[model samples]
Every structure is written in C-alpha cells, then in structure tokens.
Target: MVDVTYNSDLHFEHTLWTSELTFWGGELKSLENRLNELISHWTDKEVLTKLEHYLDEFNLQSNIVRDIQKSIQQHEINILDHTPNGSESMDIPRVKEHLKLRHKMEAQREIYGNLKKDFFLFSSENL
Candidate 1:
C-alpha cells in the first residue's frame, strides 16, 4: 500500500515535467517543415542518406525526450533546475530556420509547451 501511494505521487510529478516539453505551434512544426523542404528540394541521391540520419536521430532522441515528457506528465518537474533545450544543440543544417523557437519556453500560459526541448540536426559531413 505504501509503495502504491509513493508510485502515484511519483507519476504525478513526471506528468508535470513532460507537459513543459510539449510543442508550441511554431517551434517544432516549423523545424519539421524545414526538414521537409530539404527533403523536397534536394535532388541528389545523397539526400536519402541525410534524411536517414535525420530519422535515426529523431528516433533516438524521442525515446529520451519521451521519458522527460513522461516525467513532466507525472508532475515531477523541477522548473528552476530544468535545462533549456535539454542539450547543447542539433546539427541538422535546415534547423537554422527554427532557431527562434528557443525563445518561447511556454506555448500557452496555462499549458506547458511541447516544442521539442532539443533541436533536430543532420550532419554536413555526409553530403
């Protein structure tokens, strides 16, 4: 019974932290759009490779980011100790377009923003 009580409390904390990571209208979607533009415009076969890298990175990132989101959902967020962007940077070239998203931490006043706390980047060395 005691364990269950603790677990419930823990879950609430996790939910709160994840809520903050939620994407705002322009932040994450814009980045996705930019990546799509690169995908659409690039004629070279190498574009596939770049796209793969983007996908792979996104795949890996989502797991960790999801955990963070889960924590927020559980109300475990430490807003004061929280790190912005969650990491150093994203390497994807097209990412430059959405750099502005970093500025707005919250999507709405009452709700936490879900703008993907980290940037999604692709390496230039491949191309």
Candidate 2:
C-alpha cells in the first residue's frame, strides 16, 4: 500500500532490516495481496482518504528529492559554466554566479550527507 506516515526521520537501517525480514521471514507477497484485496473492497470515501494521505506524503518526499537533485544539477552546471570548454574563458560575472551556486550546492549536499550519516548510525546502534 502507500507509506503515508509523514516522517523524514525514517531510519535507513530499520528500513533495510524490515525489508530483509519481510522478504525472508515475514509475509511478503501476502501483504501485497492483502493490500490489493483491501483496495478492491475499499469504498469511495475510504479510497479517497487513502489517496489524499498518500499524495501528501508523496509530495513531501518528492520536494525533498527534487531539491537535492536540483542542487546537484546546479553544481554540475556551475562547474561547466566556470570551465572553458570553448575558445573563450568565463568572464567575471559568470564566474561569480558559478561560484555562488557551487558553494550553495556544496553546502546543501553536506547537510544531506550529514543527516543520512546520522540517521544510519543512530538506527544501526538502536537496531
């Protein structure tokens, strides 16, 4: 079904462990089948609520991934813009914009990295 719980605090290690357990020892296919069955039986009101919740969670996750991806893409663009691939070198204005965007992207990546590292380490220890 939909993972509608709003938590950016999802532990990676916990997820990995749960996934492994599910496939190995837990109800893997049965869970999917059960969900399908529920969907099949769901009323219009219930289905709409489920969809709404899932959509909200999906959008939240989407925004996060999009922002990170955009930052990385911008970093690459900045690097390319700064480098002289053609005959002419980058001028002062272009160089300034490139450096600014590159720095912002680097900072954002660092934040994402640190959060992931902390989440993994914490979950590993707790698990």
Candidate 3:
C-alpha cells in the first residue's frame, strides 16, 4: 500500500514537471520568434544590445530545460524498469513504437540538421 502510494505520487510529480517543461519550451520558442522580429525591425544600437542580452538569457534558460529533461527522462525510465509483475518486456513495446515514429521523422531530422549546419557555417563566414 505504501509502495503504491509512493509510486502514484512520483508519477504525478513527474507528469507535472513534464508539463511545466513543455510549457517553458513553448514559451521560449515564442519569445525567440518575437525577439527575432524585433531585431529585424530596429537598428538602434542600444536596443540591439538589449535584444542580444535577452537572447543570451533565453539560451541559458533553454540549456537549463534540456538538463532537466534529461534528468526527468532518466527518472521515467527507471520507474518503467521497476513496474509490477517483473514485466521487463513492457518497455520493449515502447521501444518498438518509438523506433517506428523515429523512422517517420527521419526526413524532419535531416532537414533540421542541414538547416542548423548551414546556419552556423553561414553565420561564421559573416563574422
């Protein structure tokens, strides 16, 4: 009974944390878009400096989110591993499903990778 309650509490906490992380990600993405737009329109040096500062802060926040996500994912995997009935095979089905979805996302991954690489290469040349 205590174990069940503990597991239930852990699950709820994990869910809440996951949702918060997702919300933060969305907010950060939206903020990035808005900042980009602002940077595009204004040529004032002071404003540009401020925008750069904001971007740095956003990047820091993003890094923190990524770290938290890694921790959360590790915890979730641990919980999955310790399920009742010694159901070790349960994770196999999830892995298979993830693999299937990953295959479907291969194109997206390629496009993103190319764009990211191109952006860095192009930006470096400009600098």
Winning candidate number (TM-score) = 3
Arrange candidates, best TM-score first: 3, 1, 2
TM-score to native of every candidate shown: 0.37, 0.36, 0.58
Cα lDDT tens digits, model 2, 1-127, are: 7333111122232244334333422332343344455556657775546534444443443355455445445644554555555523445554455446446545744654564455346435532
lDDT of 3 by residue, 1-127 (tens): 3212344555566576667667767777876787688779878787677676666666666676676667667756765765666443334444444344334335433543464455346335532
Candidate 3 achieves a global lDDT of: 0.59
**Compared with the true structure, what per-residue lDDT tens digits does model 1 show for residues 32-124?**
566676777677777766664564544444454565454343322333223245432223321321222222223332222222322322334
TM-score of 2: 0.36
The per-model lDDT (C-alpha) reads 0.41, 0.44, 0.59
Residue 3, model 1, lDDT: 18
* Candidate structures ordered by lDDT, highest first: 3, 2, 1
State the weakest 10-residue window (summed lDDT) of model 3: 1-10
Top-lDDT candidate index:
3
Q: What are the runs in model 1 whose C-alpha is more than 4 Å off?
A: 1-20, 23-26, 75-127
Q: By how many angstroms RMSD does model 1 differ from the true structure?
A: 16.1
* Better candidate number, 1 or 3, judged by lDDT: 3
